[model samples]
Structure formats: structure tokens, C-alpha cells
Target: MATGLLALLDDIAGIAKVAAASLDDAAGQAARAGGKAVGVVIDDTAVTPRYVTGFSPSREVPIVWKIALGSLRNKLHFLLPGALLLSLFAPWAITPLLMLGGAYLCFEGAEKVAEAIRPHHTEVQASAAPARDPQALEDEKVRSAVKTDFILSAEIMALTLATVAESPFATQVFVLAVVGIGITLFVYGIVALIVKADDAGLALAREPRPASTLLGLRAAPAGAPTGGDRALGPVTQAFGRALVRGMPVLLRGLGILGTAAMIWVGGGIIVHGLESYGLGAIGHTIEHAAEAAGAWLPVLSGAASWLVTAALSGVLGLALGAALIPLAHYVVTPVLRSLKA
Candidate 1:
């Protein structure tokens, strides 16, 4: 009986070890998958802040939290199951679906570029429109943001699913869940910080406690005037002022980066998908150009090659998106309108 019990315990230990290793492997895969979908993550983060615009300061974090929950629901409840179903039953469809999502990213990025070049009249009109009821407007904004988030979330999940397409079923599930949850938390957390940064800076500048207190410096001489009056207080206020001034610049930079990342990532996906479909001419040309560029600078060859490839891919994506814009404005819009009619 003792020997049998020892064997059972040994088996249990082996199983436990396997489970631990599997979890570690899943975590590693999750990181890589999240990295692959980072462009969408950036765009999502960049896009969400606008939804909270015009709302009172107090509502920003709560609005973001609600949208984050909606995003989470979209990913875990809808996209994850669909992705797993496709992976299990129609793996071949993944590439096409990814390409479609890539095209969408390209479209969105290009539209932004176009709007920057020439402002849309409707958008201007909307900006000037009269305000609605605060409660109703907030609800509308949240719903609209969540709806937009669904598209972006779907793309993120699809990219992640494609990344883990070859993993075991269990590992795929683990990776998808981790990437979904981790990315939702990360994007929304950064967004929350961004939207409230000015508030934080304002509070810091107005703080009654000595700035030294924040840094663990010597305690203020028994109730000394704080904020800009105390030693290092001016410095703290200056820093806070700088933060207030920098937030707008930071947001604009993020917008630019998000647009560029979308085009770059989308174009890369389309090019790779074409290559996989035996339509490798464009990809091959780009690859050769990149290789030539790489050969010119041996020390920085890898970086040069990657930059060349990305630039070429962006050019391709821009052309494709520009071509689609007219089609979207004309045929697609009219068709949908008529269908609704």
C-alpha cells in the first residue's frame, strides 16, 4: 500500500510539473502575440481619448473604464470563440481574414491622413453642432466608442489568433485570453493616465505639502508655506506646468504614431499574405530592395533592411487605401444606403 501511494504521488508531481511548464510556455506565447498586435493597441489607445473629449473632467476615467469593459467583452466573448472556431475548423481562412483586417487598418490610417490634408466638411459641421443633454451625450459617446472599439478589438484578436495558429489548442486559448486581458488593461490604463495627466499636474502644482516631501527630502521647517513658496516647490510647480503643456503635444504625437503604425503593420500583413498565396511579386521586389539597402551598411544592415521594407510597404498601403477611398465614398456608401432604404 505504501509503494502504491508513493507511485500515485509521483504521478501527481509529474502532472503538476507539466502544468506549470505549460503555463510558462503560454505566458511566453502571449507576450509575443501581444507584441504582434501592438499597432492596433496603439491606435485603440489613441482613438479612445477623443470619445471622452468635451465631457467634464470627472467623467473621463469612468468613461474610459466603461469602454474598457466593453472592449474586454468584445474580445473574450465574441472574437475569441470565433477565432478558436476558425482555427479549429477553417484554419485556411485565417490568412484571408487577416488580410481583410489589414486592409481596414490601412483604410482608417489613410482616411486620417486625408483628413489632415483637407478637413472634412461634415466633421467640421459636427464639431460646431449644438450640445445635447449631458447624460444622453455621455451615453451616446460611450456606446459609439464601444462600437468603434469592437472593430479594433476584433482586429487585435484576429492578429493574436493568427500568431498562435500553430500552437496546441490549450496553448492557443491561454495565449488569446492573456493577450486579450493584458492588452485591454494596458491600453486603458495608459489612456486613463493620459486623459488625467493635466489634472494630476494641476493638483501637484497646487499641493499644500512641500515638494521635498514628495522626494523624501528633509521635512519642511514646521509648517512652512508649501507649493511654490517652499524650497524645491518652484521646481515641482515648474515640472507640473511642463506636464500640463506637454500633454497636448504627447497626444498629437501618439495620434501620428498610431496612424503610421497602422499603415506599416497593415501593409506588412497584406504583403506577407500575398506571399503565402503564391502572389509574391510585390513582396519579392520589396525584399530585394530591402536586401540591397541592407548590403550598403553592414553594421546597420538589419535596421536598414527593416526600415526599407516598412517604407515600401507603407507606400503600397497608401496607394491601396487611396484607391479604395473613392470606391467607399461612392459605390459602398450608395449601396448600403439603398439597402437600408
Candidate 2:
């Protein structure tokens, strides 16, 4: 009886060790999967802040939090399970679905670029609609943001799924869960900080002494001022001023980067999907060009190859998106409008 009990204990220990190793492997794979979806992640982060743009200062963080929660719900509740089911049953559909999502991204990115180059009369007219109450506006914004987040989250989750397609089903589930939670946290955390940064700067500019104290100054008596207090105020205010000036530019740059990233990622996905379908002419041409560039720049071969590929992808994405814009405006939009009617 003693020997049998010892053997049972040994088996339990072995199982525990295996479980621990499997968890570690899942974590490593999750990190890699998340890395592969970084482009979509950046686009997600960049696209989010605009939703909170017109809101009051007090509402900004709350709005961001609400949207973040929606994003969490999108990834954890919807996309994760849907992706798992698709992976299990309709594995072949994954690439085509991903390409569809990629096309949407390209369309969105190109629309933004077009708007930047020439203001859209339709958008201007739409903006002229009667304003709603603040609460209603806020609700509308949150809903819009959430809807947008759902699409981006789907793309991110799909990209993650593709990266881990070779893993066992159980492992894939574990890895995807890790990625979804981690990415939601990371993206929304940065967004929260970004939307509130101007307010934070304003607070610092208005009340530099307290800001200085937080920075490292020892607290002074309730009525008495410290010597360091006087010295830090100007410095803090100046820093705050810089931050205020810099934030708009930073946000604008992020918007541009996000748009470009969408196009680049979307184009790459479509091109790869074509290659998989044996329609590899465009991809082959790009690859040959990249190889030639790599040969020419021996020292920076890898970087040159990547740059060439990225440039071509961006061009293709832009072209495709431009083509789709007219189709969407004429056919898709009209159909959607009619359906709604």
C-alpha cells in the first residue's frame, strides 16, 4: 500500500511539471503572436483617441474607460470564441476572412488620406446635423468607438490566430486569451494616458507647486512656501507649456502613422493571401525587387528588403483602397442605406 501511494504521488508531480511547462510554452507563443499583430495594435491605439476628442475634460477618462471595456468585451467575449470555432471547423475560411478585414482597413486608411488631401463635402454636411444633448452625444460617441474597436480587435485577434495556427487547439486557446487580455490592457492604457495628457499638462501649468512636490519636493507647511517651490514653478510651467504644444503634433503624427500602418498591414495580408491561392505574380515581383535591393545593399540587406516590401505593400493598399472608395460610395453605401430604410 505504501509503495502504491508513493507511485501515485510521483505521477501527480510529473503531471504538475508538465502542466507548468505547457503554461510557460503558451505564454511564449502568446507573446510572439501579439508581436506579429503589432501593426493592427498600433492602428487600434491611434484610432481610439478621436472618439473622445470633443468631450469635456471630466468625461474624457470615463469615455476612454468605457471604450476600453467595450474593446475587452469585443476580444474576450466575441472574437476569441468565434475565432476558435472558425479555427476548429472552417479553417480554410480564415484566410479569406482575414483578407476581407484587411480590405476594410485599407479602405478606412485611404478614406482618411483622401479626407486629408481634400475635405469631404458629405462629411461636412453630416457634421452639420443638429447637435444632441451632452449625454446623448457621449453615448453616441461611445457606441461608435466600440463599433470601430470591434473591427480592429477582430483584425488583431485574427492575425494572432494565424500566427498560432500550428499550435494545438488547447494551446491556441490559452495563447489567444493571453494576447487578447494583454493587448486590450496595453492599448487602452496608452490611450487613457494620451487623452488625459493635455489635461495633466494644464493642471501642471496651473498648479506647478503641487506638481513639483509630486515630482520629488518635500511637502511644505500649509501656509509656508519653500525655496525649491519658487525655483520649480517656472520650470514646471515651461515643461507643461512644451507638453501642451507638443501633444497636438504628437496626436497628429500618431494619426498619420496609424493610417499608414493600416494600409501597410492590410496590403501585406491581401498579397500573402493571393500568394497562398497561387496568384503570386505581384508578390513574386515584389520579392524579386526586394532581393535585388538586398544584393545592392549588402550591409543593410535585411532593412532594404523590408523597406522595399513595405513600400510596395503600401502602394498596393492605397491603390486597392482608392478603387474601393467609389464602389463603396456608389454601391455598398446605397445598399446599406436601402437595407436600413
Say which candidate scores most in lDDT: 1
Q: Put down candidate 1 lDDT per residue, 285-329, tens digits, no spaces.
A: 999999999999889999999899989998988877777789888
TM agreement with the true structure for every prediction:
0.90, 0.88
Alpha-carbon local distance difference test for all models: 0.89, 0.88
Per residue, candidate 2 scores C-alpha lDDT tens digits across 1-341 of 99999999999999999999998988998998898677788888888889998888899989999998998899999999999999999999889998998898889889999999999564467677897899989999999999988988999898888888878999989988999999999998999998888887877777757464866656654676666677877888877777888888988888888898889888988999999899999999999999999999999999999899988998999999999999999999999999999
Error of 2 at 191 (Å): 1.1
Q: Clash pairs of candidate 1?
A: none
Candidate 2: worst-modelled 10 consecutive residues by lDDT: 212-221
Q: What's the CA error at residue 225 for candidate 1, in Å?
A: 4.5
What would the TM-score be for candidate 2 when compared with the true structure?
0.88
Can you tell me which runs of candidate 1 are displaced by over 4 Å?
Answer: 1-14, 121-131, 207-210, 214-221, 225-229
Off by over 4 Å in 2: 1-18, 121-131, 208-211, 221-228
